[model samples]
Target: MTAETHAVRRGSARSHTVPTATGGGKRRDIQGLRALAVGLVVVFHLLPSLVPGGYIGVDVFFVISGFLITAHLVRELESTGRVRITEFWARRVRRLLPASLLVLAVCVVLTFTVMPAITRPQNFTEIAFASGYVLNWNLAASAVDYLNATNPESLVQHYWSLSVEEQFYLVWPILLTVAVFIAARSRMRAPSTRPLSASVTTRRGVLAALLLVFILSLAFSIYETARSQPSAYFITTTRAWEFALGGLVALVPGLRLSEALRAALSWIALGAIVACAFLFGPGTAFPGSIALIPVIATAILILVGDSRAAFSPQRLAHVAPVQSVGDLSYSIYLWHWPLIVVVAANVSAWPSWVRIPLILVVTYVLAVVTERFVERPFRKPRGAFRRRSVTFGTMAASIGVIVTVTVLATVGIQNAVDQRQDDLQEQLSGGGSSSSECIGAQAVYNDCADPFAYTDLVDPAFAQEDGPWAWFDSELAATACSSATVGSWVERSCAFDGASDDDPQVLLIGDSHADHIASPLQRIAEDRGWALRVETRQACNPFRVAAESDDENAARCASWGADVIAQTVADPDIDVVIVSTRGDSGVWEANAATAFRDLEAAGKSVVVVSDTPNVDGRQVSNGDLITGPACVLAAGSVDDACSWDDERRDTWVEDTAAAEGVPVLDLRSLVCPDGVCHAIVGGLIAFSDENHLSGSYALSLAGWFDRELTPIIDGASARG
Candidate 1:
């Protein structure tokens, strides 16, 4: 989960540097800054312990890009009083699209060939987003979605930073053009003898506008960072302030500073940035008010002006190795991530010492070759290629090719998935389900000749994607009510109709863990002549365990829990209540015990279901951190593929239920047979991803649910 948010583009070698207020050739210090930022990001991804806050390197890149691009655009705006949006876009396309599109194309090929098949659908989906320069928004949405909880980072996830860069390339130029328009109007209205010339008016207007963007975006960044850090981290709105700060530096007039002072300030700012890299970590809430520390320091470093004083930061930046790395930072960033991910997947046993240097060497070589062949040729191309229409056309075609490649690859993968579904279905019809000797729990629990005999199910490539889906609605989920309707009691609550008023009224309530059981419970209701209503919320236990946190989400969950508890108790038609949750803390257990007592006092029958076999979260006896989903994906249902959880889950369930003298529906035998659990049970992918019970596997256990729940339903019917 390292966020390796690499910055995308760099100028070609002929004139790769930006000028200060005082015009100059390539700035070795700026190049050094690129080296520092990329080095931090690369090291963070490779050696996170050494540089946890290295992710802030992306913010540094953001500022560098904003400053460089805004400087280039404003020079034109001040000279001409108008900005050419298409011409600006065409230049960006030439500098970036060739290298980026080539990498994306290569990624498409690797996803089809080298990457794990289970990851292709997601990988290709993100590739499409990256192709459109919208991967940041896609990532922001995914970060907040509970359904995507186990969706691992894709090969091109690092493109999110580049996506933000592309969006800025589009918007910033337009904003500058508008600033020029405002300046032109003001100039026309000014007196003929006015001292403020056209260039001064335009610069003043742009400075004012950029300053507004800085303030508004920084305030929004702070506000949103506190509200939703995950989403805040990737969105353009929250990050625009970083770029605005850089733009302000680009436009602001420079000071006449002594060499010693410039060197002192540059080195200090540079050290502060590197120090912040060490200070931050995965747990840190990013790019909020805290981000201002590094962002402001970067602007100050730029503001002080570039210098090559022997002890200054620029001297270190200009060193042969640093300058070389900075020259290829964009290409290195692109190639290194996919290579590292692929190597880790294929050779996980290799230690970091071996993997890190090997990846960096290979990455540097690739970067050198890509910059030489792909990047240089396309940038500032000759006659026909330099035409704005041709550059635009080439960009469109490159995007089309990537989209086409991804679509074709995805279709082929889907076809294989479809064939897998057919094969599993054929097995089921050929007595996989009827005998109860294979598929799901029976294969393990029953006295079958070979417990793993049937082994008939969709391939892990397809099955790992399975998840609880009862929250979706055609009708009974209520109008405009679905998984998105969480945060309140009145929404996302579904009611399955009963045949008659006298039918036993049952309510299944809790969080996502409760949702996994919906498949079988609905079958139980239909078969046993009972009415069922499934009321589940994301991460919100029926007991409101989040009451301790002051977060808005926690408050919403707390309010929802209180509302459901009272409403379920007040509704006389409700006869039985079933509760299950992941039970994040001991507070949930105490609250569950209290809730059980309340239900019993209301004359309602209650059943407590134990949490699932949790090898995914629990520590192993040998202290190995192997995950069940990962084991299943690699080893299938083979011997020793089965693993044991810490064995505390069953005890917790019993202790919570025993407090109120309620019956605990202990289904450990079905999930973890005799203290051993298989990644795939009864030939079905037992978990959606490591933990959540897959809907398909849950449905396969319908027979067991019927046998066990019949008594509870009969008693509830008698009570009703």
Candidate 2:
């Protein structure tokens, strides 16, 4: 979510939210606030170090919306006895849909043509959600799902805030109508003291409702923020309180503070927003207790600005710089994020000073054109948009454009994936190598010519989808088994194929390296009649002492590691402990050896798999940046495409385990058979994203893995 500053609210002369004009001129105070909010967001996106907490600019807009919309609704309830919900919705469509859809159309062009081909499908999915104005819920689900937690940022990531605002627009007017009904029903029983007394009662009822919303939403925000900050950051429930705070301000517009107090409070509120912009960063837990700083400060500033008297000295918001920016705030907010994202990813060689200014100039220029051409044309009720049917139709048509583009783009992406799959199938059949071994790493052992060669690689999207995290999630989140999970939230079976009490009890446990192989190995366990129990944490090393570290993740790893180690050694039914880790030197080696020695002493058969190659490093040659499957996608089936020469980390776990009387299963030779490694070998893509093997590639190596582990499993089974 990004800057979504609304235009100044035009209220009746006696309205609580009436804009304050300066010296008989139109009010620009709200425009100034919009300018400040959008400026903070743009600066944060461009040069985050300068304004770490500038993300709160979104909260500023939320308060502004709540205040203005609530004021307008309450005014209608007083004067006309009801809100024009249809007109309000039509107006919202006119104001928002035009520029928002324009940006999304541009995003569609970028995703299909200019962006990485491997991730176009994923990008299109996000685009579809953005078009639907539910991108925030999509993002929240992704945030909660550990499988999707590491997804790359999309072009429309900032649209999540707009989605929240759209939802509020949809629900707030209906709620105000409810308050009207409440007032009417109450008046039927008790007599009125004055004319339009029902309106007064309705306002009070609305005020009470807003107060309850503010309190409950704020409390839920704090609770959910602590429980899961990533999900809470985007979900609307965590943000309702900010809007309620603004509504409450609108309800109490006549709290007559002195002119001196208004001036002081406005300046102080502005200062507070600035402080939040500078002080808060990504690490700060948000939309919870911390978000109150900017939300409350923004409400106070709006309250004070609207309350200022005619003779009062012009406030900061009435100034020219702020007013100009606020005038084009919506357009600027829409354009800046996509520009920053694209520029940073593609033109990283440029220094921050050079890039930031260039980005700002381009964004401002685009905003100027959009404000004049796109935004202005839609704001006026003319031609097709004049009819309410046509107004809503225009919204449907705008969304339809995004949907059509996404569909066409996704079809192209799917065709490319299908072509790649077909080409790989042909290559294997055309070859004279062992037909059974013409898959992934097994091709190397079976002496297939140019085993690392390929004419087509597994699509990067498929490679990512090939990770075994889903089964881990099933085991961790589902009811079928008691497998280890991140927070111990649920118990699930980590088995690939089903097993029972009569099967050999084999345990595969480690960090993510073990996980990469778990899917294929699950099949291996089933074929061998072994009860495979798999558990892997992302960064946790399988060590006894849990080498000291300051990172909170490391602390979690330590705790998880300790629990896993104790469980394995204590459980006599566990036939073998298959340990894998990305081992390092120093205390890490010492910890690994100690853990292995203890496992051996407990009479548990132990086998250590070597660490995989260092496939995670970035390839930044000249000005080109190739990541994940980009190298393969660029090279396209060349003999050396997507190959790496690094080989240092291959045996860290193997060597340490061997020293502690643990049998070693070194697969470096299989992965990098000729002292060079390729991401795709024998038509199979290996590493998912530089860290772990694709489940497809891992499953393809079942034969060799089974051979190495059978003797270990057989020994343990005999003992049991």
Candidate 3:
């Protein structure tokens, strides 16, 4: 969790809530708010589309927590005359930390048993960072990131919000302390008979300040949500004022009103709050202008609802089952998200409909267990706080030990895996060039390999492609492409220089995979002196066309593919067009074939590279399971265990490529043999995942490519 800047929202919330002087206990209102927020959050998680704006529940919870905590602190100051910071913090740590640490411990154990070896290190990092309340910043940084797509480690990406809340609590009390001290100093200087326990001076000043903060924060939240929703949603900065809003309400004194007036206000506030919830769905622009309605409405309800007669909603919230769940809401919230993510990862065919009941049952079970075993014991203000503190400190120390042991264990496991791989490499040595060397260049291997040992593609000596390669930021591209001497984004050109305009050649086309082979293909282009030019776009397939459909992105993809083909074929100077793509069905087949036929009539040969077979199984990446690559390599011609296929993809290569009369360059014989193949070729693993060989592996196949490719180029050119 990133540290958030504090302001007026941190003020004591007495003035904003029901007065302490009025003995009408409003536990029912608090219970109702809790129930409403918890239900919304659970429903949102289970079926976000049902209540699209259900995420506002978090904001509501923030307000309630801020109000209650500030109200409690103010009352304590009034009674004791001196605030105990350590005791307050100790209470917070006791209340929140133990269960959190236990969750991490359980996650670590589960991860070791179920998770792949490749992602363990990342999981460890996430666990450590999350344990320390910094997961929000980590997640925000990852949302638009370029690297680590294949082996993203954290199974619990949802903990980012928890981190934000934890960090907020850290500084909030200190500021509250300052407010209390200032109030005390001013009261001591005054000639008053009664002690200024709940003085109007501090309350009014704090409320005014909080009002300013609330307005400014609302603006920031709106701007941030508009520009970067994920960051704004997860970060502490945009969320703090909601909590502060609740605190502001708690600090302000309640208005004296008749029973009828109070009852009327209560109903209005409750109706407004519920109306906001029911009317808005998940699609609502949130943590922005829309949030104010719910926050302010909640504040009003809390202030007014205690005096009113029992409403159905308030009655429901006060029910035993609902109140029990409300008490366990924090634990339920913590457990549910990670459970959803992990379950989804394991079973892609998750029924969204059935998931709600499953979530309710599971969240309830976990929440109950945590409350009984973890939360209840720590909440007692006896020796309980000290004992819980020691227990958490021990758990924290244990985590450090576990991380150390896991790292060492991982090192051992990797070394052993590498050794086995090395032995196999020697046996297959003369057959093919080391794929690891080429695949290493493209940093996409991190997701499938141990990043600690992974090789990068951009040559240190090469000026053009050596810098930082983050996709979100272009500055990273400049850094990635730069070398020892001159670091620049443009005009740093290096090429084979062998391929000239006069030479008859093939044009390779597609997305990043196509882009990846530019260097290796350039090597081939240089050797053969062929005019092989690359025309590629990131994530775009070369043979698709715009569909006359509502899915505009698909339509756009189809259009892009047609344009690429049309542009390539129009250049009569080129002899052939080489086409390759990853996993996608040939939705573009009819349009692709039409464009190709036009090209063939115009006298250009079109060669298609069939999609490579991916690894088949539930394994996330070959890197995660230390033995996954070895298992693939040693599977011994088993068709079921070796080959991967997507039903849609089969239509393109197996059927459409045949129908199109395009000569297919069958690399299946090179990669797969006797119905099975190793992820490793020769001494190095060719692929980081089930498909797409590492840059090194791809480059090593150049000689084999040249052998078959040169003949095709020569034969096609001779005919022309």
Candidate models: Cα lDDT each:
0.75, 0.73, 0.58
Candidate 1 overall lDDT versus native: 0.75
Q: In candidate 2, what are the lDDT values of residues 222-324, reduced to their tens digit?
A: 9888777887899888999998888887776344455666656777888899999998999999988988888988887766654334433335566676777
lDDT tens per residue, model 1, 58-78 = 999899888888887788887
Q: How well does candidate 3 match the true structure in TM-score terms?
A: 0.62
* Model 3 stretches with alpha carbons more than 4 Å out: 1-26, 76-83, 115-122, 146-155, 178-198, 257-284, 341-359, 381-720
- Evaluate candidate 2 by giving its C-alpha RMSD to the native, one decimal: 5.7
- Alpha-carbon RMSD, each predicted model: 5.0, 5.7, 10.6
> In terms of TM-score, which candidate is strongest?
1
Q: Residue 61's C-alpha lDDT in candidate 1?
A: 89
lDDT of 3: 0.58
